[model samples]
Target: FLRAIGKARLITPLRSEGGHRRYSRYQLRIAARARELVDQGTPIEAACRIVVLEDQLEEAQRINAEYRRAAEQADPPPAD
Candidate 1:
């Protein structure tokens, strides 16, 4: 599974001094999602793309939430 995703360029784990590839928590999380997709009969390539898009969407949502909070603070709602 690791080799599959690495070949697809999804998650690239770092090489250790002993020449062993080491995966971080972040990378593991992505790999887990890909594995789930693969288990459900999705192709590896498509699964990787889905994982990447999901991450992008999550980041966008986080940024939008911050902007919303800022806007609300800048202009409070009028008294009811």
Candidate 2:
């Protein structure tokens, strides 16, 4: 799939006798974000921009808070 999309260049290649591919954490993050954006109806170029330039820290925090609240609202563990 990566090769099909021409995103293989976004990843780093490992240097071996035959030159293998090795992706870094940053590359993986970019690919994941790209996939997410693509799933959300964003074009590849726009998705790359959002993933690379958009400040999503606040949104991430909000989502985390929502999840925490939901978890707290769930029933507690029963007595042993």
Model 1, span 1-80: residue lDDT tens: 99999999999989999999999999999999999999999999999999999999999999999999999999999999
User: What residue pairs are clashing in model 1?
Assistant: none
lDDT comparing candidate 1 with the true structure? 0.98
RMSD of each: 0.8, 7.9
Which lDDT values do the candidates have, in the order given? 0.98, 0.66
TM-score of each: 0.94, 0.48
**Deviation from native of the Cα of residue 59 in model 1, angstroms:** 0.7
The alpha-carbon deviation from the true structure for residue 61 of candidate 2, after best TM-score superposition, in angstroms, is: 14
Give the alpha carbon lDDT tens digit for every residue of 1-80 in model 2: 34523453443445567776566676667688778888989877677667655546657888999998888779655779
For this target, which candidate reaches the highest lDDT against the unseen true structure?
A: 1
Flag regions of model 1 displaced more than 4 Å: none
